[model samples]
Target: MAETIFADRVLIGGRIQKDVLIEIDDGRIGEIRINTSGNSSAFRVPSSCLVIPGFVDIHCHGFGPDSFGAGFASARRATLAHRARGTTSLVAGLVSSDTEDTSRAIASLATLTGEGIIDGVFLEGPFISVARRGAHREGFVRPVDLGLLSHWLEQSKGTIRMVTLAPELSGALDAIRFLVREGVVAAIGHTDATYEETRSAIDAGASVATHLGNGMPSLFARQPGPLLALMESPKVSCELIADGRHVHPCLVRYFVNHAISGVPIFVSDCLGVEGEGKHIALVSDRLVEMDDGAVVFKDNGKLAGTALPLSGILKSSVTKAGIDLITAVSAATIGPARTIGLEDRGKIETGYRADLVLLNGTSLDVARVMRCGNWVVEKHEYE
Candidate 1:
């Protein structure tokens, strides 16, 4: 059956188009009619609501392994939780852990990605700095082991899309080169690298700054650490956690506006426990709990992860971080989709996958989500 949706304003091709009519044919966008004369027969978006593409989150946890316990069922639960709330695309995030456990998790998540439950896998580290590890287990931290990296890649069978590592680690530049050649995103994070080291890594094909402003050294005027280097490089995609706590709002504005040359991708970095997935000792097997609105480690009080889902992050990105709606929406949607080479399913354009989200214009609450042209029924009806 064919279906049509009408909205006063719909986000398409990175801008809002007025009075648009989107026709869905066989789960794909068919004809997008702009300046439609108010099709009352079509499913109409509320006047106060904004219709945008479903969100794409490149950095997040709660599936497969590392602290939150193991099992594919748990990973499905995490993916479903995010999908129900409008994050139609997600990259399963894993923290530093034993090679055996990490490989097992990667295999499971690769299966999940194969099944189209999640987008892909992101290994936060087994190759990060111990001092800058933050919530990661220090025992699992080590210098870049090219052999281990190659093993994981072979085990993942192409599901591993992103890997975070420190440039200061031994053989990191070589590993970055290998990852780039293999079509994987080499992300810079959890590092104690200097500006020069970061530049070297970037030049060596490290194309992403994972969760920038966190898991790395602070930016100093005299020192000008990795943060400056990552921001200055034109080839890097900077990942910013948008729960309004990971990076200062002022810094968020600067980064979204002038600090970065590449796309500023907003992420949740939530631990995959439904609401406020916090106060839990599941991240990298490090003892942690929720302090205030943020998740922190129990021993040293460093940030472990976030409790907010991508919905909360989107709301905060606009209301708290002072980022424009279009820019924030792009960060959450197309920017992330384009970063990892997902050419489809992130925008409301012609011939794209009909995945979309409708939100309250003022409050920014997710009113409803439509994945592949089907509206999501709430749990109340499911049960």
Candidate 2:
């Protein structure tokens, strides 16, 4: 049996330790020991690099300039661009559109999911409320119907991991129930729902509040809305955009401090304009700009997707926002992976696929990225 050794500082659980030796055999971790004093040939990680597990973006829509709803080929190309950013596993999210348009989007994602590029799909609307629709098209926003949701789920062939909807509308509770029955994650978002209504949705199997505090009513003194309800719920997980545009820094801190600890995930909520140099992405055929470090629609009046890459999200949280590095990375990695039930690829542990990213200890630049043991990105030279 041929074996190779990787000697470096490893970030396991939540701590980093030096002189960690991980032995690999047949592309699987054979053993891991901390300076066991053996003659194991060692390959050092570039100095000042920390090896962590690959990122899991549970709610990124598309990559490059192409939207997932555009076409399968376009989505595939977009996702490959996403992987180059160190997102080894990700859920392709969709915005609200007409039923026919959504149907086509789901069909296209089904093809990419079958090919294993997209792990699953998350449909974020078309059943949301117009009051809090944000950028979702008003024409397509409607009440949640289980039959319709089931149709879309069936079309995806069990690859639909999550759906975001307004929980106060007619048949919303039933839709939540049906989605849970079918093993789909039901997320509440884009609504004017009151605390009671949001609580009822959580009781009815809704487990997430999409981009909590964004896409919903703010917590008022008189009426603590969906945001407050989700923060108080023991059964719910929440999502944050953390890009500094979608939310304020204090609110992000409050969310990290209060809401279900170790449960909420960070989503890019990233619209289609990931890479493509200021090209305004189209939402419902309207031009949206990827400009000035944020994705803006119509010249800074409306917030579209984020130009915030995942790496930048982590760095900003730690460096700019004063968040603990491990906690911030967890929100981006383990939290999303578990939220979507992808147990195979989140943490740096044995028996998990070695999909990982190496980062600069201080600057947070991506030092290297690996997918299934292949060097997809390398920032340092190794002989």
Candidate 3:
């Protein structure tokens, strides 16, 4: 099957180009002709529209891989919810859990990965920090346990693509080395690491700073914590959660623009508790709720995670954080795809997957979503 799109503005090569024609053959991009040059009949659109690559959410916890009562059916529903909101590639997130529970979640998510239900699995740690484990249950958070991690990787059948661990934990450097050796990403998150400790981890192989400004200390002038260390490395990837509540809007802007020498990408970090009226769930035997536009722990009133999907996150990123559409879209799309080594999607270039999202010019809202050369959502063209 062949389809052609005549887009007023197409995001390509990290910038926007005007009046373009994109050709698709068998779900992959065939050619991108600039300026159209008389190609007027192919999926016509006005100048008031913008087409960008479909989002790649490397971190979202929405009923995702390893939550309570998570099954293939429920997980698929969560994945589809992200898809409906312009996310073409999603990596289901698993909070820190017991070894047995983690193994089970990995098994289920690994099967989904094999079936193409999700892009991959990100285990956000049984090896993180207990003190900085925001919303991550404390009892299950432990020191870097390479034995348990090895078991998970084997059980995953090569499906666990990323793991989050604190650099300050005992045996963490060795764990980072092992993870890198096995082709898994070693991410620094939920840590109380000083700048020196963080530098050591990065030197050992930690390439990603998981949710950079969150799950870590504030960048105090005297202390100058891990935030600076992580941002100093050009090879690291900083994951930013642009949800209005997680990190302040001002900080979000700063982080997006100036905080990282490394690449900055956006993640939803959704907790899957977003629902009508009110929703409640048990997280590690603690009560968590989503209501009235907030997801929080019932006991201590601490934020659990965002209630929005990637679409809402993007909107907040642009409107609340005062980010331009071009930068915001790139951060959400190509930046994250490349961060996770998914080079085939997140671009409108030849030989890339035809995963694109059409957005309203004025509102920047998702108008239509195309995945694998098929329209997965109802047609809502920019009119």
Candidate 4:
């Protein structure tokens, strides 16, 4: 049966509107009516609530005790956790590993993508810089090899949507060109590239900067680095880890205010370790404590990915980062969707997929989540 949801405030066309009714049929939005008497059978959200499109996380490794290398079963559990937290779509991010292990992991995840359990795979390593590699094993970081990349791409069966590489590495420009030809996004990250090398990659079709500030060298006053190159590029979109730890809130605001190509994307880059949810002794030899709603590395007080949920990121974007609500929401929704080329979702519109979340208007807490017109997380249940 078709369902109708009436909300007093609905995010539409990048802004909130009043008295909106969204009709869902066959897992897609059928129509959107404004300023009309809602159907008698329509389900009405509280007048104090706001409805928005479900978040699209283009770069996420795992969720809730499940990491990508743990296979399909673990991936499914992670997907569930993210979905409950209002991430309706995400790419399964894979870190650097041996060729056989990487291929196996991608093959395992391809099944989940086929089943719609996850969106696709993001290969975040093997072709990265050893000097800048954060948590990835140093031994596994290698030069870009087109043959190996093609093999892994085949193993993914067209589900490998993005690959992160260091623009300064040997054959890196050629790799970016190959990825572009293969319809995959080549992202520059885990790099120690000079500005000219970074620009070369962008010219060769590198379109994204992976976890912008974390994996690259810090910027110097006299010499601009990859960060500046990524920021200045007209065609590149930068991914930011908004856990309030990976990148400072001030830089997040600066990027949002200055980014010219498009809105910066907020990615979890989570390694599936939620400090409160799972008890892991070592996340890269660093202890974690669920501190102030974020996962903090106890030793040096850095972030080990984020225990902060995507919804929490949205809240932080508004409350702490001082970003406007609509632009913050766009960073998590349409911005990442555009980065990954997913057009059917990331927006609330007629004929779009019925993936949405309802939030407590004041707190911005996720109260309900609907994916593909099916209620996944409902604060209130109907008999």
Candidate 5:
């Protein structure tokens, strides 16, 4: 069945326009007509709503009670949780674990990607640096092994869309080249690489800086680090965790303003533990309430992963980081889509997929979410 949505203000071509009519047919956008002069017969969205492209999160681990490494049922719960929060597309991120466990997780997530439940999978490690492993298990961290990577890629059945590795490690540049040749995005991260080592990887085909500042060394006054190298690389896209807890607001603002790619991609990197309403007793003999909605960690305060959703990221970008609404939306939407070579679904235009989120004009709360022309969430209907 064909349907039309009359949006009072629709974001298209990087600008918001009023009185827009979007026609949907068979799960794609059929036509977009702008400046419709007061035609109220169609299904009208309120004027206080802003219709924009659905968010694309290229680096999210899990949500709710589910995580990628847990299996298919947990992956489904995680995907659904994110989708309900307005992320229409997601890349399931898997952290470093035992080789067999990582392979199993990849195979399980591949099934969901094949079914279109998730966009793809991001292998966020065994090929990372042990010195900057963050929450990854050190026992699982290893040197870049081409045979192992090839085996994992085969197990994924071509659903592995991106891989994060340290560029300074032995054979890391060769791994990046192989990943690029196989049409997967090779990202630089989890490293203590110097400026020249980072540059070498970027020259070899690494084009994304995974969670730019985290899991990496900080900048020195005399010697530049991977972060600066990423900022200066024209071909690289920097992924930022905008949950306010991982990074400070001032640095976020600087990256948004001065990144060579013009706009940084925002990723949730959430571990699916937010809003669980449980109190955790840490090894330090302190109790922290999960209701605080912060990222989890072990007793030593070593960072695990975030608890933020994409919606909360948008709010933080605007409220805490001082980014404009449109720019923040672009970071969450088209920026990540472009980074991973997904060109079809991140924009509101003719011939694009009909994936959209309707937000309250003032509060920017997600009022409705539509994926492939089907309404997945309609807040007013529930109310």
Candidate 6:
């Protein structure tokens, strides 16, 4: 076994302590033990920085440097960029489009999965409400049909991790139940669902509320929508886009404190246009132009996607969301890991893969990223 030791003023299992040592052999965590003898020379540490577990993101469509919505090579390129940014495991999210195009994206992702890059694929729509379609193409937004979905699932060869649907739509509740029975995660989003409909969906085995507050209607003083209804579901975990543009900072703070009983996974909700420089993005065949960080469709004044990075989300989660670094990082890491049923990663512990990030100071800016014990990206190396 190839042996190595890493130590730091470590945060272990959510606590900060000194001289924490992690032993690694063959890229797996061999053992984790603390040295209380006040002796610094016992274990070899590569650096004095804090080490966090590999981050897992369940809902990033693509990274800034690459565009996946256009084709397969772009998706693979985006996946590589995301890995460099501390996303050790990710679900390649695809927006609703023509069935043929969607099939092609799935097929491309299936190829990547065979090569061990993506954990699985997440189909975000095609069964969402037309009223709350957001940036997705309305032409592609249709009611759920179990037969069609099962066929698509079959085409992917059982690699679909999650699917987002509106519960009140035709065939949605049954689809939710079917997905649950098959061990696939069903997420509720892009909906105009009433409280009763949202509750019914949860009861039917929908477990995730995708980008909870952004894609669905907000709470009313009397008639609460899917967002508040999801808050009431004990079985459902909420997905939050910590990107400051998608949600208000105060509301994010409130949700972090109150809305979720379980870990709230932070999703980027990023589009392919991101990190590719300023350009008009086509949403639903409508052109959306970005100006000074805001995306707007000139034709209708509708907001498109944000050009925000996960690092930006982490910073805002601390400064704007009133959350500490550890809690926010947990939301970004272990929360998503548990959401997708990934058993082995997302925590700094023994027997875990050494996918880690070294951030500078308290800012959470990724100065270096190591995936599976390989230094895939280093800041100074680039500088």
Between 4 and 6, whose lDDT is larger?
Answer: 4
Question: By summed lDDT, which 10 consecutive residues of candidate 4 come out lowest?
Answer: 273-282
User: TM-score of every model?
Assistant: 0.93, 0.92, 0.92, 0.94, 0.94, 0.91
lDDT of model number 6: 0.76
lDDT of 2 by residue, 127-206 (tens): 89888888787888877767788899999989899999898899888888988999999999988899999989999999
Task: Give all candidates' CA lDDT scores.
Answer: 0.84, 0.77, 0.82, 0.84, 0.84, 0.76
For residues 23-63, could you state the per-residue lDDT of candidate 6 as single tens digits?
Answer: 56677776677864334434444454566777787887775
lDDT of 5 by residue, 219-256 (tens): 89987889899888888889888766677888888888
Let me know the TM-score candidate 4 reaches against the reference structure: 0.94
How many clashes in each structure?
1, 0, 0, 0, 1, 0
| TM-score for candidate 2, residues paired by index | 0.92
Best by TM-score: 4
Query: How well is each residue in 1-383 modelled by candidate 1, as lDDT tens digits?
Result: 78999899898887789999999988888899998775667998888989999999888886212222265888877777777788988888887888888888888898988998888899999899988988777788977889999999999899899999999988999999999999999999999999999999999999899999998889888989999999988899999997778998889999999889887999888774332333454445456676544677676777776866677788888888899998999999888999888898678988888889998889998888988778876442111
In candidate 5, the residue pairs with backbone N, CA or C atoms under 3 Å apart (3 or more residues apart, or in different chains) clash, namely 63-272
Those runs of model 4 whose alpha carbons end farther than 4 Å from true positions after fitting are 274-280, 285-287, 293-301, 377-383
Model 2 RMSD, rounded to 1 decimal: 3.3
Steric clash pairs (candidate 3): none
In candidate 6, the residue pairs with backbone N, CA or C atoms under 3 Å apart (3 or more residues apart, or in different chains) clash, namely none
Candidate 2 residue spans exceeding 4 A from truth: 1-7, 25-27, 36-42, 259-262, 274-281, 377-383
For candidate 3, the TM-score is 0.92
Alpha-carbon error at 278 in model 1, in Å?
7.0
Task: Put down candidate 3 lDDT per residue, 183-250, tens digits, no spaces.
Answer: 98899999999999999999998999998888899889888889999988998999888876778889
